[model samples]
Target: MTNAGPDGRRIEEALTGGNMEPVVRIDDTVRRVAGPWTPAVHALLDTLVRGGVPEVPSPIGIDDQGREILTYLPGTVLDDVPPETRWSDSILQQTGGLLRRMHDASTSLIGGGRHVRTWRSASHEPVEVVCHNDFAPYNLLVTADRLSGVIDFDFASPGPRIRDLAYLAYRMAPFAEDALDDSGFTAGEREARLERLIAAYGVPFESSEVLRVGADRLLELADFTDARAVETGRTDLPEHAAMYRRDAVLLVGLSSPQH
Candidate 1:
């Protein structure tokens, strides 16, 4: 691909890879190609545009080559943290509110949206809106410990609210020894932070019903990951599946007050 833009300055700064397409950061824009998940992503962007989601970037339309262009959101994504920074209650609370807002806006688009897999369970009913399936810290932009924006909606789809929440908790919780490697904190500390986050989101943290449903949804995610890995012939994904199982065990164990 050519590196020069209309102004003759170097446009490509970085490239984020995916199974479907490549995400290139150029000057002040992000260009994404039509990947396997393109239809789902386009559906999500359409919903966000119609709903007027404030923090998400507005899609500028597709190029002649069918690549999507979006305004670049400024801020650092919290994929990795420096040792000095701590995961505090306030940050967790903000994240909860952000998630709630996104879920609320997504209701209208729930069943109409498209994506990789359908997230359905007996407890959590499906809703219609764009779901950012990978709404983890890595995809979120933060400034001064506050959520500024989000990116990389490659896995966005229509699904249940709890499905998204379960994924978020799975990624955010420090249930294993290696969990703190990225967050720079201990498992206990991260659990406490996650508890505060759940409470802040107005989710019933103490309800047996909620816990049961969340656990089931989490297991569903594990099954999905394992199945996808096997189908795609990814040899390395079984390790992830094993880690998730271990993590699930630790999560259940820690949920008991006696633990």
Candidate 2:
């Protein structure tokens, strides 16, 4: 599905015009739409303007038609299995550091404002940086086992750091039983992989911070999905939404402070 405008015009012209092969190359350009979400994305890129965010595409501007233009970021996106394993210690560490930096930079922009909170578990105290809410394998660009860049900032938002981290963990180390197979591993093997990932990212095992808030995040995702489905008049997503809600409850049940 292309990112189309409300009037359904293709707006990701710059990205499509480029012949450069991105990690996750999409022939169909993301059509831009003018709305609350698009401007929020623009605000995020604005925040990253001064900081040394490596290889980020430059935003052109909001078009008269209300579409946003951005330079196409380059790198290889490792979407699944064999590619997913390409995620190395350096990449995880870099990603962790990048996230930290983004959070630090975001403090100034959204430090004290009534902003929209995407996750219900998120504290409404003050907004942190604009999180690439969908930071995952598909959105990341990798080269030689290191994170080269990121793409798809459509879900960017001002929110808590933990919310972004939890979303990453949820995507990377999902609660689904089949995720192991998708990653080309057995259940026991996948567990080991997850342990290594957490270690590589320096996520404290004893903290229980990610686990404590996981259920709420999942519920929030479910609610968001349900709302989107309704808005788009699509009934196909409710089953998956229900599954996520159930999985979130299961995850909460499995949580332990002992790590």
Candidate 3:
């Protein structure tokens, strides 16, 4: 495939975790196909940067091709790393802390009409903060065992703080079935890591609450994925939905009192 853009700049690489939009890197900038939600996400990023939250990408103007441009963060995204590396204790703790910083920074947007702005993802009630709805390892940038940056705000929307935390716990704590790929830990490790993550966030939350919320989040995501598959004609997404459902069941079981 040709790696040159219409402007003749050499495309450095095609980024992953862009399930809906095409993303590419050029020089010190990354470009992604923009949607109606682009403006809101850019505004959120700008607000976070102005507020001294240093871990997210800086939004540049849109390109001639109608793509949103962002200053490239120089670190390896967790998706490109080995499974064991993605499951490290330091990574889990760092991600939890970074998420706390992001949520805290994003709370500033709640009162500014930013909470009701257009987003690709649906907003939930009690909008305490802007949730990076997909806070999984795939969207995290790591350097020297630290979560140095976060990317891909396409799914962000206004929601409760624990909404983001729950999704993060589901993916990082990984309450998925063992048959799936990248199911990094044994069932016994889920609660421990979940507790560790919540502790790092420095919040008072029950692990069971997180698990229950995580299950609900997964069901919502499954429906979203199924709809996207139908809209985009991506044959593989139904399987992705199935996996989400399976994981949701696991989380529900884990959250139950008998367990």
State the lDDT at 148 in candidate 2. 70
lDDT of 2 by residue, 1-259 (tens): 6665688764333432211122222233233444556555656666676666753555667656566656556566656325345434455556666656666666656755565433312343235556666666667776666667666676566666676766565556555432435655554553454455556455465324665566677888789789878887778778768977887875676566443
lDDT of 1 by residue, 58-153 (tens): 677676667888877887765554423325556567777777777776676554335343332222445544567666666777776677777777
lDDT of 2: 0.58
lDDT (0-100) at residue 182 of candidate 3?
76
Assess every candidate by TM-score.
0.74, 0.71, 0.91
The TM-score between candidate 2 and the true structure equals: 0.71
- CA lDDT for candidate 3: 0.84
Per model, state how many residue pairs clash: 6, 4, 0
Q: How far does residue 146 in candidate 3 sit from its true spot (Å)? A: 1.8
* Alpha-carbon deviation at 219 in model 2, angstroms: 0.7
Better of 2 and 3 by lDDT: 3
Clashes of 2: 4
State the C-alpha lDDT per candidate: 0.63, 0.58, 0.84
Q: Rank the candidates by lDDT, best first.
A: 3, 1, 2
